[model samples]
Target: MKFTEELREENKDIFQAIFHHPFVRGLGEGELPEDAVAHYVKADYEYLNTFMQLYGTAISQSKKREDISFFQGQVAFVLGDEIHPHRNLCEYIGIPYEQLQGFPLPPTADHYRTHMKSVATDGLLGKTIAAMLPCPWTYQEIGRELKEEFAPEAEHPFFEWIDFYAADSIDETVDYLKKRLDEEAEAASPEDRQLMKEAFRKSCQLEYAFWEMSYTKEDWPIREEVLK
Candidate 1:
């Protein structure tokens, strides 16, 4: 079966909900709050740091030496190249890098970290890849939307970040991930497929929560006034 078909069959609800979300739809059209986009970039960078650390630990624990080395390389590329470049996104949104680093991660972020760690440590590589698939795919899809909807206007802060990730590189990232998932799936057992599906669904739900957390504000009068 085709990869897209397999994804549809395995994650039907998640795919539908993501496509229907207002923020995601807006992101597709190059419309999102500047603050929100900045939050996403910062959040994603921090999450990668934690993820890579866990991936490193998992690789160290693996008995398969060659597989351990492969995972190590994957972690390095994702951290050193893919994730590190956007570390300064906090500055663009008027937040200091130190402040972003010190800020408490939301529950959604914690959930994502836990899920990835679990997959990396205990599940098949294919399952782990499945768990990681939604993030890049979602970003690429949103980027496509932004390119189509907001390229001409290009004035919004959110659109600025959107355009950068959704560019040609994002397509390449998605293609690479798709190929990885296919290869992993071909080698996976039925149990591994089930594990991958479960982890993928959980990760998607956490992703939705991550976005929601960014938009939510605590009811603090002083903070509200300051925001104004």
Candidate 2:
């Protein structure tokens, strides 16, 4: 099997947990609390902010001009589609978008972002793309799955959210990522290919933590009172 296929098979348990998480389940039912969604929007903005940097790194490091073009296109997608919509979400959640930007990231956000940076900055080009693949690919997959199961109406709270992920654009983007990853791994030896799988696996695990953190509103251990 190809590395991406193998990675999915090896990590099927975590994938199941993510696909079946209460947060995702709630999204399907439109039963999730707005507060949780609010927290997620805030944290995810921070995530996308750092995510842009990683894409920039990938663009700089890529050896092929077409690879550079793809990464640059992804950067634009992040800004235009990924990040800009949060402004309206901020409005819906009754917080100014500017205020959402000011909130400090929770520990989970930092850990995932830090890991992404480390991989994109330090890993092989193939592995760096490997690290980046899970987010879009997995999200769109879940979105497509739930969109069919829920068939949410236009007015549903989470409908637009589902639309974002289930868009044809997302599928196209993830397909590009997957194609690149497959091509990169095609000629790689067994040992080097394993590194790509490991990177993709770790990113998938972090993807789960990211959703859980938003739903649980995970907080850092330090207390404000104790700090003083």
- Candidate 1, 218: how far from true, in Å? 7.6
lDDT of each: 0.64, 0.81
lDDT per residue for candidate 2 within 180-205, as digits (tens), equals: 78888997788878878888888899
Q: In candidate 1, what are the lDDT values of residues 1-228, reduced to their tens digit?
A: 955458757766766676667666655554556666566665666787876786566566556776577567768667566643354345345665555554445557766888887787774566666777777777676566556765734455455556656778667656765776686767778877777777777877876777675655212234435877
Worst 10 residues of 2 by lDDT: 83-92
The candidate maximizing TM-score is: 2
Per-prediction TM-score: 0.73, 0.92
Show where candidate 2 strays beyond 4 Å. Answer: 84-92, 224-226
Q: Tell how far residue 98 is off in model 1, in angstroms.
A: 3.7
